[model samples]
Every structure is written in structure tokens, then in C-alpha cells.
Target: MGCCVSLFSRKPRLEKDHWQHTQNRRSSSAKGASALSGGGGSSGFTEFTLAELKAATNNFSSDNIVSESGEKAPNVVYEGRLQNRRWIAVKKFTKMAWPDPKQFAEEANEVGKLRHKRLANLIGYCCDGDERLLVAEFMPNETLAKHLFHWENQTPEWAMRLRVAFYIAEALDYCSNEGRPLYHDLNAYRVLFDENGDPRLSCFGLMKNSRDGKSYSTNLAYTPPEYLRNGRVTPESVAFSFGTVLLDLLSGKHIPPSHALDMIRGKNILLLMDSHLEGNFLIEEATVVLGLASQCLQYEPRERPKTKDLVSTLAPLQNKPDVPSHVMLGIPKQEETPPTPQHPLSPMGDACSRMDLTAIHQILVMTHYKDDEGTNELSFQEWTQQMRDMLDARKRGDLAFRDKDFKSAIDCYSQFIDVGTMISPTVHARRSLCYLMCDQPDAALRDAMQAQCVYPDWSTAFYMQAVALAKLDMHKDAADMLNEATVLEEKKQRGGKGP
Candidate 1:
């Protein structure tokens, strides 16, 4: 008789899992840090005194607190204007194990050296006795969550949403490359819009993890699977968290990866799209984004895509280009509020139809466009061939545009347009967006007008034209264009032929 295979007779030899190895590496690194004399063992970093920080923050008064959560926790953040009248965010940490002033200074110095365009640059740090604080460049705009999750203003356009995702990925990639392999608590709140309306990742993420026993304020549903399993994070863990942010952009809600993965695999992604994105977002792009998110959310940490890959993949899907971070983040207008859209006509739709000619002319003058050779009318078969060529050219443009290669997109889209076989409104609109991104508002307006001429009743064409008109300060023309587009859209919906 063959030896009976006993159930649970012997346990398999244990192999160190990915998280275990990561933890080991982290432990060794910490030991290495501890061995240094302090400074995180380097120098050249500004060290602010406790008294200086207190004065800057008005003695840590409640009035200066800037954290939206309104929590009086040990880790509190304050908005302070420094001596030179430069605004800075001051973070006061409640006491923990960082007692060695030299060691704390050293760590802060090492982290402070981390600088990237996407990061809110770290200005300095303070570690005076029991008091520990960090100072960073102040971001005028609020957190990404306030814009994407709960905005009082207009929701970010599909293109801007895509851009934000790409920006964060690039920021994470920068951190990993700079030797700070792990970003603690990567989330929407950590991304802020600067004065120029560009998104900047909070450099405060470079600080050591909280020692005061506080954890993430967000729901665990969005946390990486590895973090839940081992109570630790790796670079891959940050990627997993980023995947959740993508989900938020796509669905406008916090959803568990397990459920989201199920929907993705089932080809039911349309059900998960944000309602606000209806008619604006493309199914193909959404699928690609979802695919990336799924890869990032993979169960095996090793299987997750790297930050480099994430950046490369997302660069092409950016629809609208150069949208100010303030606009995308819904930064409150200081004075005049723009006109709100009537029902059935979205704000963007209205804005586009109204036309911003002054803005358009300003943007137009900024870019140089190739002459429009003009398209010739074609027979059905010839049109089909032209369409194929147009699509191929547009495909190249889309990829270039996603990568923020505006010049290339313009060239490719121009080729498609010059061929002039297909009357594809979307292609025209896409090229217009590219033109706008490249600061060629004239080119943008031209494309928008061409789109309208091709598809007389399409709202997008009118909207694009209106944007150009409004930008050019042709308010009357812009308003009229917008009214025409709205009326046309309403007429179309009512099953009429034309306005």
C-alpha cells in the first residue's frame, strides 16, 4: 500500500513573504539611521527653532489651524506667514520617540533634500527639545478630495481628472527615485493646488510616520491589501493606494478593490463611472484607466506596476491640457462668479457655447499653427479610406497628447484634418483641446469652428467655440454662440432637425 498522505501531517517550509522581506529591509535601514550622529546624518538643511515656529503660528492658536478635518489632535497643522511675508504650512507633532535632537535634525535634513516640481517643497524643520515641527511651502488651494469628492464648484473635467492622476503618479515616481521609497498615507488630501493652480504633493509626506498612535482618517477600504495584512507599507503599497485614487476619479466614490475588480473583470465599468462625467469621458480611455488601476490593485505586491510605468501609462489619457490646478480643484472665485448653466446644459457646455474670444485670442497668439490646407469632399469609399487614415493619425495624436507632447499631437491632428475625409466632431474637438493646451487659442478656435461646421447640432462644437470666443474677450459673440448651442441641443433632444 502506498504511504497514506496524511491531512495536515506536516507544515510546508515557510518562505519569507514580500512584506516580510520589506519589513526586514526597513528595520535594517532604521538601524542604519540610528547609527548616525543626527542631522538624518547629513547637513545644509534649515533648522527652525521652536520659538520661531510658535511665533509664526501665533502660539499654535486655533485661529491659525488650516486642517479641514478640524481635529485638535497631537499632529496639528497651521498656516503661517513667515518673516518675509512668505506663507508656509507649519506642522506641530505631538511628542514621540524622536528625542535625540541631532537624529531628528538629520532625518529632517535627509527628507528635506527631496525636491520635485510636483512636491510642495519642504522649507525647514524644528526639533527643539520635546517640540517637533515641519515647515513646507504653503499651497493656496485646498486638498484634492475637496475638489474631486465634495466640490461646491464645477467638477473637474475628464481631462483634468486624468491629469491629476498622472501628476500624483509622477510625484510618487519622483519620491521613489529620490531614495524615499515609501510615501506614508498617500491620498487625495496630501495633494494640494498651488497659487498657479498646479497640483503639488505635500512634502510633509516625507516625514517619519506618526509616533503618537494616530492612523489614517480615511476608510480602510481604500488602503492597500498588503498594508492590511502586515501593518506596513512598501513602494508597491503606495501604488496600490494610488489605484484607489484612480477609482475615486472614475467613480467619484470610495469603493473596495475587491468589488471594483469584480466589475472591471465583468466589463461592467460603465456602471461605475461618475455621473458628472457622462457624455464627456470616453469609454476607451476609461477602460485603459481601469486596466491600470486593476494592475496597481493586484493582490501580489510584486505584481503591481511601478511608478514609472504608471506615469507612462497615464500620460496619454490626459484629455484637457494645462487646466489650472485651481480650476480643476474648484478653487473659489475671489470676486465675480461665472455664469451657471441652465438645466440640461452643463456648465462646461454653457461656457463653451458662450465662447471666450479674448481668452481664445490670447491663447491663439501664444501658439503657431500650420496653415489649414482644407479637406476636399469625397465619395463613400474614398471617405472610408480617409477615415482610416484620419483615425490612425488621430491615434498617434491621442498618445502624444496623453504624454503631454502637444507639438506632436498638433502635427498628427493637423495631418488628419488636412486629409479632410471624415467629419468626426470628436477628432476636431480633441485637436482643439490639444491646441488650447499648447497655448494656441486661435488654432483651438479654428478647430472648434470647424467641428461646429461639420456637426451643426453638436453641443461640444459650440462649447469649444464659445470657450475660444470668451478667451478672446468677444463676449457678445461668445454669448450668442452659447445660446445657439443650447437651443440647438434642446431642439435636437426634442426630435427637431435644427435650431
Candidate 2:
């Protein structure tokens, strides 16, 4: 690990000329990452003058060898330096794509500098010509994916997978729901394991702050259906991915799509278990993981659990040796996840928003005393009426935002934000999400930025900038923004997102 860089404290900002020095970056960052990957060298953020990177990364050698040798290799690639030495694995980008590079860079910048037993640190980078790079401490183990796919060596024990699954979920939940844009990608490939077999998320190229990453490297099979269908990417996707990963851990195989569908139907779900586990795991754990996975994969995005909820669910998985062996072959043979228990919709709340299963569930819960299990429990007519009312609310909010109704949008969200005793970060994120929908980047940027500011050191705000930048076609800027966010976030907590 490395020492922390003081971002909030104040440091000389980089000069523009250094970043714009080259039209070509591959020629510069080829040497530095390895030297920057560990501690006792470049502990904090290391900004390299263009010339330094030119000497280190061999000018961005395509053969730079980002991944390690053998079946277990690292997923991210980078070229940077540490403590004035070269040959580090962390990387800095040239002409970063994120909308708010400062935000991400600020965060990731810190990551390179700190050192801790549980937390990894940032080391160094290449600074030249519209590109900024950071060298972060690298973990030795391969990601959870290696075990999940297990092409050669023995697969990770089922209990270990379950333990990892729970821990990873909690980590991601805290990162996302704690009001930061720090969304974990659940890139099985990025969850590294070492000689000691400890699990860690290799976030050099992940856990980015983005407006939307539904299209990013997520496993399609694990992604929430809403994100897959709509351009809008929400936290529900994160929950969905978490649930899927949990199920996969138990099953000892990627859940097959067909089997998943059966689970939804409430069919023979026990058959979904991984035979390799050979009854080594418990039915209770398998049932719970499966149940949660089904909930997360709800056909409607709204019905899924929030990352925070996943965090609550995950706390129980750690240190459980008897954790079950479940595997995802696909949708379960059972019934699809059931509907959400909605509270009655507030008058000021979104209307069509209620049409989203999640919204509907919220409305039902708010309005009704108990869940109506019978078909006649709540007349189809009454449910339709409630839905219509929510739709109207949604329409009104949309109309206002469309009409430049910032106040109305804010008002609508405010109502939801203050709803009941629990104000989910999703609501806040969604409120800001409105700005993007309304074509107001500055506003959205502010809201997103505020999320970071209020929750300083979280990834969500950084993500807002990343997505805003990406939405504006600033891929390089988006990437850079993610970098800053990670750096800042890394400093506050390792394997944890900021609050």
C-alpha cells in the first residue's frame, strides 16, 4: 500500500502543457505501472512528466503485458511508475474521457498514495498530453472469475465462494448506496485472489463513477432487465448483478438462462445446485442465496433490492463455512421473483413511475395495510387506478422537467426523498437522474457533484460526472473522471466506497 495524497488539503494542479504535449500517448506510458504496483516506493499519487512515461512504458507497448501469466491473470492494464522508479502496473490515461476528470482523478489519485493491511494504495502515473495516469498497488490473486470459470486448476471451495460473494456484495452495497457513484462492476475477472487466497476487487479499471454503465463490461446474463432494455442505467442493475453473483457462487457455475426462468416459475430449483459441491453446502444457504438472486433478477428493475439492501443481506455470509453450493445455470425452474410490496404512492410522487414494478410496490405498501395475496385482494380495477394515479404523477414530473421544471422535479423527488423513515440513495441518485433526462447536464452535474460533495469521497458523484461526460460524448473525459473518483474514494476506505 502507499501513503495518501492530500486532495482536499491542496496540491499544485498539473499544468496544461504537460498533458497536451503529445498527440500520441501509447508512446509514453509503456514503462511505469509495475514499479508503481506495490508499497515502499511510490506510496501516494505519483505524477510523471511525459518524459518519464516515455522511458517507462516503452511508449505504451501493446505487448506491455497488462495481465499476468497462466490461467489466473489480472483484468486491468496500465503503465506507470512509483518513487521515481518505473515498471509499475497502475496506469494513467491520456486525454481522459470522463466529464469530470477532476472528480475521479481526485479519488483515484488518493488510491495510489495510501497503504494499509486491508486497503490497497495508489503509486504513480504518466502525465502527458491530454492524458493522466496513476500507478496503483496491485493485489496478487486472480479475480473470482478465474474460480468461477476454473479452466485448469481446482475451483475455489464452495464455502469460500459464498464468503467472497457476501463480502463483495457488502462492499459494493456500501460503495453504491452510501451516496457515492462508486458502482462495482462485479467483473468476475476483476475480483483477484492471491497465494493466500484472500479475495479482493481489482478496481484499477472498475468501480467507476458513471451516469450509466449498463452497457459497460457487465455480464449480460447478470444485468437487470431494465438496464438492458432502457438507455437508463440504475442501481437496480448493481443489485441484480450482486444477486446473480451470489447465486453463481452457490451453484458453482454461471446460472443458465433456462434454469433461471424455471426458478421464476417456482419449479424444481434444487436441480440448479452444482453437483461438484456434492452436498458440501447447506440447503438453507442455497435457498437464501437463490431467493435473493431471484429477487434481484426481478423482471421489473424497480422490484430489485437496493445495494444497501444487498449489504444487509450480505453481512450474514462472511465466515460461514457451511455456506451452500448453488450455481446459476439460468433462471430457476420456479416462479419469477414476486412483485415488490409497494407502499401507497404519494400524491406528489411520480405517476407512471409507479408503473415500474418497484414504484408499484412502494405504492402498495404505502397505501395498503397488508399485501393482497388473493387475486381479489386488491381488485385488478383498484390496482389499475393506483397505477394510473402514479402514472399521472410521473407524467406531471416529466412534463415539469420537460418544461424546464427544475422546481417541480426537485419537488417531486423531495417528496420521495422524505418518504417514510428510509430515504434510499437510489432516490437521490434518481432525482439527479432527472436532470440528465431533462437535458440539463449542468444541473445534473451539480446534483451528481453534490452527491460527492455531501458524501465526500464516494464514487456516485464521480460516476455522475463520468456518465455526464460520456453522455456528452466525452469518453476520454469520462474515463478520467472515473480515475479521479477512484483515487479520492480509495483514500477514504479500501475495498469500501465513501459515505
Candidate 3:
């Protein structure tokens, strides 16, 4: 790992020229995506009338409300189901005093166009006569905070928690590219999980702070130092909020950034990790996350790592393979007794469901295929030598992957794959990720697709394909691939056939 960059060091902000280039690229992407997908709504958004929203939310019944309560709350969220039976979340700004409805809708439409796998994409908006509302894809799995702090059921596994960090960071990084827009009041609550059990940043985060009001929901301790001192938020302020979220993930509890910084400086982050993760977590990975979190919590806004840096850092820490949302979130599956099935539950099933790629690798490394008999046909010496060779190559790959030496890791994994000692989905997945890091999207996509073909039930393969596709700017296709991955994941997690 590289030495931590000092947070106090000021970095140049994205200049106007950069913004112009970004906008041009965005326009090209939209055109390309629409042309390639043959769909007009590549943005995956819509516009709604107030009456339609009212109908979807049962006339804004109290039972449908999802956020804080108040007769005239400044902003409130409601859970709604559109006429098409698609579940959605509606954010109504009661106090937002936009003078022109056309201007408000235009601004809302601009936000809607900003889409990414990690964002809860804006589905539509309603700006009718004094009513201003934005509708988003409803996340049934609820907020990250609910699982982290208020879980009445099983807590999320270490892998799921780590994935959440990656998802949010990716979302923010995409936002930065779109226009370094201010993501006000970013916290665990703003991060929600989709039906596929993937984490998504709420679209509301992109709303300009002026519209959301100056008051923050969290304590001053958690607010960025700039916001605390100047009562103003900049792009860096959003980064600071991201840092607080990182702290929350590391500690498994909310700790003020100042106090968290004290722990980080003292190298006592191990003491802050969630007690539940102690036995199940990897020390090395946790240390990396803690270090990154500490950097994010730096006092000077200039010192903080930007969303792009966070995305780069987190993309690797998301080590585990993709697990179905239902299993990761601990959502109960519907009971069903299966008749005779072709693909019975294998040892790999449970490990893969939990995203325990390490365990899967160990199992694969240990596995020795027999010649159609339940017997070790090889001589003891020959078997031992073969095992040693396989283990050595796998170890090399693992080390290279951990060190972020994607080229070396790809070489090592390729050697193992060529030998064909044992069938392992994780090797394919890992190599695919390495290919992505090496900017070989075609190879990455190929490997990911091959992995999926080899293990149709594995969600990780689909996720890899999604990443590769996104890199290629095939956003619509990537989304479709992700949905497929999520479906297969959900089925496998529920102990059903991959449909």
C-alpha cells in the first residue's frame, strides 16, 4: 500500500474546461447508449403528474411515508407503487419555493439523466401547481443505517458491508464526473439497497444544498470542518460526509469524525471495528479500509480524498464475489420444497451465496479430481507435488491481486487457468477484475462472460460483466446485465435453480 497522502495538501478543483469536456462526453454517451440499445429512455427515467403521484402513494397516506414525520416537513419521502406496479420512493419538498414550474422540472430532468448502477436512478418527477416531488426507484432492502445500527434481524456480513462502501463511492465518483454537484447530507441513511441487494446512493444527494436548506440532520461533530466553521458546503464537504460514512462502516457504529481521527492517529482502529465482524473479517482488508477512512476524515477539506480517489481505493477492497441481495440482507425467502433437481446444493453454493471467495479458493486448491471413482488414483508423491504446484500458483495470484498488481495477478491466474487443475469460479472472476484494472475491457468482458457460462448461478460473474460494460459506456446494457445477475443471485440464494 502507498503512504497516505496528507489531507492538508490542497488539490486543484475541477476547472470549467474540465466541466465542459465532461458535459460533451456525457452528451456523446447518451447518444451512443440510445443508439446501441435502440431505446429512447436509456436514462431510465420518466415524468409524472401530481395526480399520478398522489394515486401511487394512496393519496399520500400516513402509512406510506418513509421519512421523518411532520404535517409540513420541509422534505419527506413516501413509498409508492406506480400504476405499473413498480415500487417507487417519492421525495416531496414542501418548502422549496421554485418560482417557475418549468424551471424546476428542467432541473429535475437534468438530475434524472444522471444514472449509474450505484445510484437510485430518478424514475420521474411531479411539479404541479405548488406541489414539487421527485420519484425514485424504491429500494425494498432499506437504508444502510437500518442494517448497520437498527437491525432487528441478522447483521450484514463483512463482505456485504464492504460492498456498500464500494457502491456509494462509485455513485459519488459518477456524480463528480457529471458535474461535481454538491451531495448534501450524505450519511448511512442516504445509502439504500436495491432489490438485487446492491447499495445505491439516493438521488436526493445530488440536489443542490440551497434547495435542501442549511440545517443538517446530523450532529455538528459529523459535519465537515468547513461546514462547521463557515456554515457552507462545497464538493469537499460531500467528501467529508463520505469520510464519516467510512468511519461508520469501520466502527460498525457512528463515531464523530474528530474522535475517529484520534483513534486513526493512535492506530487504534481495530478497537473501533464492529464486534460482530471480529472473527469473520480479514485483518488486512479492515486495516486498509480504516486507513482510507482516516484519510477521508482529515480536518482540512483540501486534505480529504475526493470521490474519484475513494472509488479507486474501494474498488479493490470489495474483495468478495457478488452475493444475492436477499441472502446478504437477510431477507427471508419464500418456503418451497423442491422436487428432484439436477443441480443439487454443492459446497460451493453456500460459500458463493455468502460471497466467501477465499473459502471457495481454498476448497478448489484442495480438491483433486478422481478418475470416475471415489479413490485417490495418483501415487502419494505425485499427488503431493501436484498439490504444491497448484497452491504455489494460486498463492502468487492472491498476493499479486492483494497488492493491486493487476498485470502480475492476471498472469498468475492465467497460468492456473491454463493448467486446469481444478475448476474455480473465483479465479475467473478475479482475473476478470484484473483485466478491468488493466483497462482491457474486451478481455475483462470476455472473462466475465466465460465465468458466467461456467457458473451460471454465480452473481459475481454478472457483476464483472456489468463493470466491464459500464467501462465501455454501454450503460443500458450494463444495467440489464446487472438485473440478470441479481435475479440469478436471488434464485441461488433461495436454494432454487438459476433461471
- Model 2 has how many clashing residue pairs? 133
Q: Give the range where candidate 3 is weakest over 10 consecutive residues by summed lDDT.
A: 1-10
Error of 1 at 282 (Å): 1.4
Query: Per-residue alpha-carbon lDDT of model 2 for 341-411, expressed as tens digits?
Result: 12332221232222232342233235321111111122344345444444345446545544555568667
- All candidates: CA RMSD in angstroms? 23.5, 20.1, 17.2
Evaluated with lDDT, which candidate comes out highest? 3
- Which is the winner by TM-score between candidate 1 and candidate 2? 1
lDDT digits (tens) for residues 1-499 of candidate 1? 0011121111120111222232233223222322221111111124555665677778989899877645444577899864434467888877754666656656665676554557776757777768878888777778777777777767777877788888888888887886887777677778888775677788877665464332354567877777778777788888888888889889887678889999988989889898877668888998899999999999999999999999999998876675665565556533322223334565555335434433433332332221111222344454355566766887787677666677898899788766644445555776787777667766677777555444444566666766665665444335544544554456556674421
TM-score winner between 1 and 3, please give it: 3
The sequence of per-residue lDDT tens digits that candidate 3 reaches over residues 51-144 is 6678878999989988532234457799987544456788887645565666666667667656566788775676677788888867777788
Which segments of model 3 are wrong by more than 4 Å?
1-44, 68-73, 209-212, 332-499
Residue 459 in model 1: shift from native, Å? 57
Candidate scoring better on lDDT of 1 and 2: 1
Clashing pairs in 3: 7-303
The residue ranges of model 2 lying beyond 4 angstroms of the native Cα positions read 1-43, 48-88, 91-126, 132-134, 181-184, 205-215, 218-221, 256-259, 264-266, 319-499
TM-score of each: 0.56, 0.49, 0.59
Question: Looking at model 2, which ten-residue stretch has the lowest summed lDDT?
Answer: 1-10
Error of 2 at 403 (Å): 60
